[model samples]
Target: MEFYLFNLIRWILNIYYYILIARILMSWVPGMERTPIGGILYRLTEPYLSPFRRIIPPISFGGMGLDLSPIVAFLAYSFLEGGIFTVLRSLFHWVG
Candidate 1:
Protein backbone atom coordinates (compact mmCIF):
# COMPACT_ATOMS: atom_id res chain seq x y z
CA MET A 1 0.00 0.00 0.00
CA GLU A 2 2.76 2.42 0.99
CA PHE A 3 4.75 1.48 -2.11
CA TYR A 4 1.71 2.28 -4.20
CA LEU A 5 1.52 5.71 -2.63
CA PHE A 6 5.11 6.39 -3.51
CA ASN A 7 4.57 5.27 -7.07
CA LEU A 8 1.51 7.51 -7.32
CA ILE A 9 3.48 10.52 -6.16
CA ARG A 10 6.22 9.73 -8.67
CA TRP A 11 3.68 9.37 -11.44
CA ILE A 12 2.15 12.76 -10.64
CA LEU A 13 5.57 14.34 -10.75
CA ASN A 14 6.24 12.72 -14.11
CA ILE A 15 2.99 14.14 -15.43
CA TYR A 16 4.09 17.59 -14.32
CA TYR A 17 7.32 17.07 -16.20
CA TYR A 18 5.42 16.11 -19.34
CA ILE A 19 3.20 19.17 -19.09
CA LEU A 20 6.19 21.39 -18.57
CA ILE A 21 7.88 19.88 -21.61
CA ALA A 22 4.75 20.40 -23.66
CA ARG A 23 4.50 24.04 -22.64
CA ILE A 24 8.07 24.62 -23.75
CA LEU A 25 7.41 23.13 -27.14
CA MET A 26 4.14 25.03 -27.46
CA SER A 27 5.79 28.40 -26.89
CA TRP A 28 7.38 28.44 -30.32
CA VAL A 29 4.03 27.89 -32.00
CA PRO A 30 0.97 30.07 -31.73
CA GLY A 31 -2.72 28.99 -31.43
CA MET A 32 -2.22 27.01 -28.22
CA GLU A 33 -5.00 29.05 -26.62
CA ARG A 34 -7.51 27.74 -29.14
CA THR A 35 -7.63 24.29 -27.54
CA PRO A 36 -9.18 23.54 -24.11
CA ILE A 37 -6.51 21.08 -23.02
CA GLY A 38 -3.79 23.45 -24.20
CA GLY A 39 -5.30 26.22 -22.13
CA ILE A 40 -5.25 24.08 -19.00
CA LEU A 41 -1.70 22.93 -19.66
CA TYR A 42 -0.65 26.54 -20.21
CA ARG A 43 -2.28 27.62 -16.98
CA LEU A 44 -0.76 24.75 -15.03
CA THR A 45 2.73 25.33 -16.41
CA GLU A 46 3.01 29.14 -16.64
CA PRO A 47 3.50 29.84 -12.94
CA TYR A 48 6.58 27.66 -12.69
CA LEU A 49 7.97 28.62 -16.10
CA SER A 50 7.53 32.38 -15.67
CA PRO A 51 9.89 32.61 -12.73
CA PHE A 52 12.54 30.72 -14.66
CA ARG A 53 11.94 32.91 -17.70
CA ARG A 54 12.66 35.97 -15.61
CA ILE A 55 16.02 34.57 -14.61
CA ILE A 56 16.91 33.09 -17.99
CA PRO A 57 15.63 34.89 -21.05
CA PRO A 58 14.94 33.16 -24.34
CA ILE A 59 17.48 32.99 -27.14
CA SER A 60 16.72 34.36 -30.58
CA PHE A 61 17.47 32.21 -33.59
CA GLY A 62 17.39 34.79 -36.43
CA GLY A 63 13.65 35.24 -37.20
CA MET A 64 12.84 32.05 -35.29
CA GLY A 65 12.60 31.86 -31.50
CA LEU A 66 13.39 29.11 -29.01
CA ASP A 67 13.33 29.11 -25.21
CA LEU A 68 15.81 27.17 -23.12
CA SER A 69 13.98 27.44 -19.80
CA PRO A 70 12.07 24.21 -20.36
CA ILE A 71 15.30 22.35 -20.89
CA VAL A 72 16.44 23.68 -17.54
CA ALA A 73 13.16 22.55 -16.01
CA PHE A 74 13.63 19.13 -17.57
CA LEU A 75 17.09 18.94 -16.04
CA ALA A 76 15.64 20.00 -12.73
CA TYR A 77 13.04 17.26 -12.98
CA SER A 78 15.68 14.73 -13.90
CA PHE A 79 17.77 15.71 -10.90
CA LEU A 80 14.80 15.44 -8.58
CA GLU A 81 13.78 12.08 -10.03
CA GLY A 82 17.29 10.64 -10.22
CA GLY A 83 18.76 12.10 -7.04
CA ILE A 84 16.40 13.13 -4.25
CA PHE A 85 13.51 10.88 -5.24
CA THR A 86 15.75 7.88 -5.57
CA VAL A 87 17.24 8.60 -2.16
CA LEU A 88 13.80 8.89 -0.67
CA ARG A 89 12.74 5.62 -2.27
CA SER A 90 15.76 3.87 -0.85
CA LEU A 91 14.99 5.25 2.58
CA PHE A 92 11.36 4.24 2.30
CA HIS A 93 12.33 0.76 1.20
CA TRP A 94 14.64 0.42 4.14
CA VAL A 95 12.08 1.68 6.61
CA GLY A 96 8.98 -0.10 5.25
Candidate 2:
Protein backbone atom coordinates (compact mmCIF):
# COMPACT_ATOMS: atom_id res chain seq x y z
CA MET A 1 0.00 0.00 0.00
CA GLU A 2 2.78 2.41 0.83
CA PHE A 3 4.53 1.57 -2.41
CA TYR A 4 1.43 2.30 -4.41
CA LEU A 5 0.72 5.52 -2.52
CA PHE A 6 4.27 6.73 -2.90
CA ASN A 7 4.31 6.03 -6.62
CA LEU A 8 0.98 7.76 -7.07
CA ILE A 9 2.13 10.87 -5.26
CA ARG A 10 5.41 10.89 -7.17
CA TRP A 11 3.58 10.60 -10.48
CA ILE A 12 1.26 13.46 -9.65
CA LEU A 13 4.12 15.66 -8.52
CA ASN A 14 6.06 14.90 -11.70
CA ILE A 15 3.09 15.92 -13.82
CA TYR A 16 2.67 19.18 -11.94
CA TYR A 17 6.38 19.85 -12.22
CA TYR A 18 6.09 19.52 -15.98
CA ILE A 19 3.06 21.77 -15.95
CA LEU A 20 4.97 24.44 -14.07
CA ILE A 21 7.84 24.14 -16.51
CA ALA A 22 5.43 24.53 -19.43
CA ARG A 23 3.94 27.63 -17.84
CA ILE A 24 7.38 29.13 -17.32
CA LEU A 25 8.37 28.36 -20.89
CA MET A 26 5.16 29.88 -22.18
CA SER A 27 6.09 33.18 -20.56
CA TRP A 28 8.98 33.45 -22.97
CA VAL A 29 6.61 33.74 -25.92
CA PRO A 30 4.48 36.89 -26.10
CA GLY A 31 0.70 36.27 -26.13
CA MET A 32 1.27 32.58 -25.31
CA GLU A 33 -0.67 32.85 -22.08
CA ARG A 34 -3.75 33.85 -24.03
CA THR A 35 -3.78 30.52 -25.86
CA PRO A 36 -5.86 27.63 -24.56
CA ILE A 37 -2.99 25.37 -23.47
CA GLY A 38 -1.07 28.26 -21.98
CA GLY A 39 -4.15 29.45 -20.10
CA ILE A 40 -4.61 25.98 -18.63
CA LEU A 41 -0.98 25.81 -17.58
CA TYR A 42 -1.22 29.27 -16.02
CA ARG A 43 -4.32 28.36 -14.08
CA LEU A 44 -2.73 25.14 -12.84
CA THR A 45 0.59 26.69 -11.79
CA GLU A 46 -0.20 30.27 -10.76
CA PRO A 47 -1.84 29.39 -7.47
CA TYR A 48 1.26 27.49 -6.38
CA LEU A 49 3.67 30.13 -7.68
CA SER A 50 1.90 33.33 -6.59
CA PRO A 51 2.91 33.35 -2.94
CA PHE A 52 6.56 33.03 -3.88
CA ARG A 53 6.15 35.86 -6.37
CA ARG A 54 4.66 38.06 -3.70
CA ILE A 55 7.48 37.25 -1.30
CA ILE A 56 10.26 37.84 -3.82
CA PRO A 57 9.76 40.57 -6.34
CA PRO A 58 11.35 40.25 -9.77
CA ILE A 59 14.87 41.45 -10.35
CA SER A 60 15.17 44.29 -12.83
CA PHE A 61 17.91 45.17 -15.26
CA GLY A 62 17.27 48.24 -17.38
CA GLY A 63 13.62 47.86 -18.47
CA MET A 64 13.41 44.09 -18.31
CA GLY A 65 12.65 42.04 -15.21
CA LEU A 66 13.58 38.42 -14.36
CA ASP A 67 11.13 36.57 -12.18
CA LEU A 68 12.74 34.34 -9.58
CA SER A 69 9.47 32.99 -8.28
CA PRO A 70 9.64 29.88 -10.43
CA ILE A 71 13.10 29.02 -9.15
CA VAL A 72 11.91 29.45 -5.60
CA ALA A 73 8.80 27.41 -6.31
CA PHE A 74 10.92 24.60 -7.74
CA LEU A 75 13.14 24.62 -4.69
CA ALA A 76 10.13 24.51 -2.42
CA TYR A 77 8.72 21.60 -4.39
CA SER A 78 12.01 19.72 -4.13
CA PHE A 79 12.06 20.17 -0.36
CA LEU A 80 8.42 19.21 -0.01
CA GLU A 81 8.82 16.07 -2.12
CA GLY A 82 11.89 15.04 -0.19
CA GLY A 83 10.24 15.58 3.17
CA ILE A 84 7.09 13.73 2.17
CA PHE A 85 9.02 10.73 0.88
CA THR A 86 11.25 10.71 3.91
CA VAL A 87 8.27 10.50 6.23
CA LEU A 88 6.66 7.86 4.11
CA ARG A 89 9.80 5.76 4.06
CA SER A 90 10.35 5.98 7.78
CA LEU A 91 6.74 5.36 8.71
CA PHE A 92 6.04 2.54 6.28
CA HIS A 93 9.53 1.10 5.71
CA TRP A 94 8.92 1.37 2.00
CA VAL A 95 12.19 1.54 0.10
CA GLY A 96 11.90 3.26 -3.23
- TM-score per candidate, chains pooled: 0.77, 0.93
For model 1, where is the 10-residue window of minimal lDDT?
A: 87-96
**Collision count for each candidate, in order:** 0, 0
Q: What is the lDDT of candidate 2?
A: 0.92
Highest lDDT: give the candidate number.
Answer: 2
Residue lDDT tens for model 1, 8-94: 878898899888877767765689756887899889988877877787887888976567877787777788777756676687773
Candidate 1 to truth, TM? 0.77
Q: What lDDT score is found at residue 88 in candidate 2?
A: 87
lDDT per residue for candidate 2 within 1-96, as digits (tens), equals 878899998999899999989999999999999999988998998899999999999999789999988998999999998998999899998787
Best by TM-score: 2
lDDT scores for all predictions? 0.76, 0.92
